[model samples]
Target chain A: MKAIVNVGLKQGVLDDQGKATHHALDTLGFKEIVKNVRIGKQIIIELNSSNEEEARTEVTKMCEKLLANTVIEDYNIEIVG
Target chain B: MKAIVNVGLKQGVLDDQGKATHHALDTLGFKEIVKNVRIGKQIIIELNSSNEEEARTEVTKMCEKLLANTVIEDYNIEIVG
Candidate 1:
């Protein structure tokens, strides 16, 4: 199975990288890019799970254990066959 | 409208941050995280477009101009009203 984990900075969190990117974007003329600019991480993993439920369980554990920093980031996992 | 831009390393491209993350995952015991590890960026933009097609066009422009590094990343945009 294939799983995609999206880990991103929480709302209201300070994101220096995102700020830099926002500045760059503004300089390039996308001036309407309002308030928040938070960056996130995407992790694509291939696992050998036998089924979707199994894959979900394993991927959830993966996110909770290592794919995400629970304190400052939130993550969503999408399991694809 | 709101649009999400997902930008990620192209297949076969070197991803140093992803490598470091994979190493960290391994050290933390997710040994099953086999093979390639690629990282990507997600840009969620909120716009005042009146419709989906307009949002898509504007967001595509955003992606082409600054949200993605066309040389190394591939992006998908999803527009949500």
Candidate 2:
């Protein structure tokens, strides 16, 4: 099974990278085109799980334990066969 | 409008970060659980575009020009109202 995780900063959390990117875009003539930008990370994991349920459970645990900083980040997990 | 872009290393490219994470997971007792892991970036842009089509076009250009390294990265863009 394959698990895709999208991890992002929680709402209201300050994102320095995003801010820098936003500024860069504006300087590069994308100011009027873009209002805001936020950046995050995506992790794709291939596992030897038997089913989607097992994959989801294990991947979620992985996120909780190591993949994400839950204190200021939010993650969504999607499992695929 | 909102545009979401997922940028990942091209197939066959060596991803040092992914390899490090994979090794870390194994050392953390997730060896049998995960077979492979790849990491990428997710960029979300909120734009003042009129519709999804316009948003998609501009965001695609952004990805091609500044958001991703075309030589070694592949990017997927999705637009949302």
Name the best candidate (by TM-score): 2
* TM-score of each model's chain B: 0.90, 0.96
Note the clash tally of each candidate.
0, 0
| TM-score of candidate 2 against the unseen true structure | 0.96
Candidate 2: regions farther than 4 A off: none
* lDDT of candidate 2 at residue B35, scale 0 to 100: 94
Q: Cα deviation in Å at residue A81, candidate 2?
A: 2.4
Backbone clashes in candidate 2 total: 0
Residue A57 displacement (Å), model 2 = 0.9
lDDT of 2 by residue, B1-81 (tens): 888899999999998888998998898889998999999999999999877777787888788879999999999998876
Model 2 lDDT tens row, A1-81: 889999999999999999999998898888999999999999999998878887888888889989999999999998877
| Residue A49 accuracy (lDDT) in model 1 | 64
Each candidate's DockQ: 0.53, 0.91
